[model samples]
Target: MSHSIAIIGASGYTGAELIRLLATHPSFEIKALAANSKAGQSLGAVFPHLRHLDLPDLVTWEEIDFDAIDLCFCALPHKTSQEVISKLPKTVKIVDLSADFRLRDPEDYRKWYGNAHGATEMQEEAVYGLTEFYREAIAEARLVAGTGCNAATGQYILRPLIERDLIDLDEIILDLQCGVSGAGRSLKENLLHAELSEGTNAYAVGGTHRHLGEFDQEFSALAGRPVEIQFTPHLGPFNRGILATAYVRGEAEAVLEALQQAYAEEPFVVVLPMGETPSTHHVRGSNFVHIGVVADRRPGRVIVVAALDNLCKGSSGQALQNANLMLGVDETAGLMLAPCFP
Candidate 1:
């Protein structure tokens, strides 16, 4: 049984990444590719790298026949996704790659995104698509919301420890560095190669990053208390990947054991050997997430580092992982490509 799929906002980085992975999927077919500005253009015109595949010409979302599409992957921007997805057919199973539905509380959405959620009903129904933690829920959901790249990397390292009460929640701090692509395909003066290359700097500093909402929501829910961590994000010169280093107060061995046990059955998460750290280069361009735990020189302190492709495991790959459950296909299908290395 082939599932006919539509990808909205198919001209961006994440949208192109979804096409890259889904192009090889055995049970899924790309039926519609929508990009309002790029409508009527061939997909290859906007994304030359994808020219090798046969794909639908870019169309406006309004021109799509949702009734014929079994699934939809909404890769639009934050506010845009909410507006577009609200108008989509109810029968379509959607995996949204935007922040529109990731947070549960509408108030939280407003606080972070600076506007009222356009689609509260769908917001209430969206399952958080952090595949490992929300598997069963995602498998049954009609709309699954993908997690933020930085949020995904940080959660992979801390969720298990928080769940088992292995770490001191009060003292946790997440310092993450991400490639420029995670900022999306939009053009900004600061993102220009002349400005960003050969240099890196932190933005959204002092607990100001938007992904803190996710950290607060997920970590607090797991610990059954109000948990807040100091989060700071930096933009690196590279093109892809995220490396999140979490400073935690706990026994190193215990942290390693907790992560290993929690992700033991997960197909995409790998807990590297104790004391060995992971590098973003190792997990580049793949759906796999690599986590490493090591002891800090100070007693009872440890550093947990997690690495993954910001676009893959952090967004598109995770969207597909949830889609597999929603479509009742093997979770690892079309996602077995090995990490690229130079």
Candidate 2:
């Protein structure tokens, strides 16, 4: 009853994450790993932490016999994801961990990502992969597009509030701090330990963060108008987790009730008691998202916070969740492992 799986772009952090999570999954088999740059190299050579597993040796995408795979996790970079996924066979389902297909409109994709979408034909069918809101669509989708890690954290706090009219959509502000892993396993001068450690600075200020495209799309769709929240993301001095603090205009009690009611049945989302905000460390290394809400000293104002491992709940964890639904397996499979705490 096990399903064969392939990970395209398996040399990246997210690819290794998928391997770690699926290692314990009862129904998924890691059949192939495609990382052209590291092709023919064993996984251990690229990621020593994963050296203990008996996983497939790294290979180029063209080398994989796609027919043997039932699902493919496209962890490729944004511009390249659509191009690679376009060639995948119809028999295989895909969970793409990139910004390529998250935006439904080709124009929006180009605007945010600075390139024309390569797989325009697939846009209409690629479901947005925020599992909680798009569960039904993802369950039947052949392709699911994963949301940005920062975007996911913000939505976990804002979506239900928007839906219930519990907050002023136009007045929302999100200040997020995320670990380096969200930048992927690429070599960049800024990500260097000496340069990045012991310091925190904001990037994608104003309405410029690409994930805003997702927020504008989903929140606007929910509110039936363009809802643009003030979002600012910071590179935290850590290896994992994202903590997003949002300021909003609403009754604290109502916002709390709405969030609790929305996620009361959700397995991964935890709504903390009023006045208690979540820290990134609380949910580190797990597929859990901790959300908290509190009233500000000013009336009609509230503060909301959310935390999760950028690599886990925000990315691969979500991809795996959607894959489970697409494959008709238990949604929580391979995702139930508890958070790694001190």
Clashing pairs in 1: none
lDDT at position 271, candidate 1: 97
| Cα lDDT of model 2 by residue, 55-80, tens digit | 98999998999999999999999988
* lDDT tens digits by residue: candidate 1, 1-342: 999999999999999999999999999999999999999999889999999998889999999999999999999999999999999888999999999999999999999999999899999999999999999999999999999999999999999999999989899988999999999998899999999999999999988788999999999999999999999899999999999999999999999989999989988999999889999999999999999999999999999999999999999999999999999999998999999996
Against the true structure, what is each candidate's TM-score?
A: 0.99, 0.99
lDDT, candidate 1, equals 0.95
Supply candidate 1's per-residue lDDT for 143.
Answer: 97
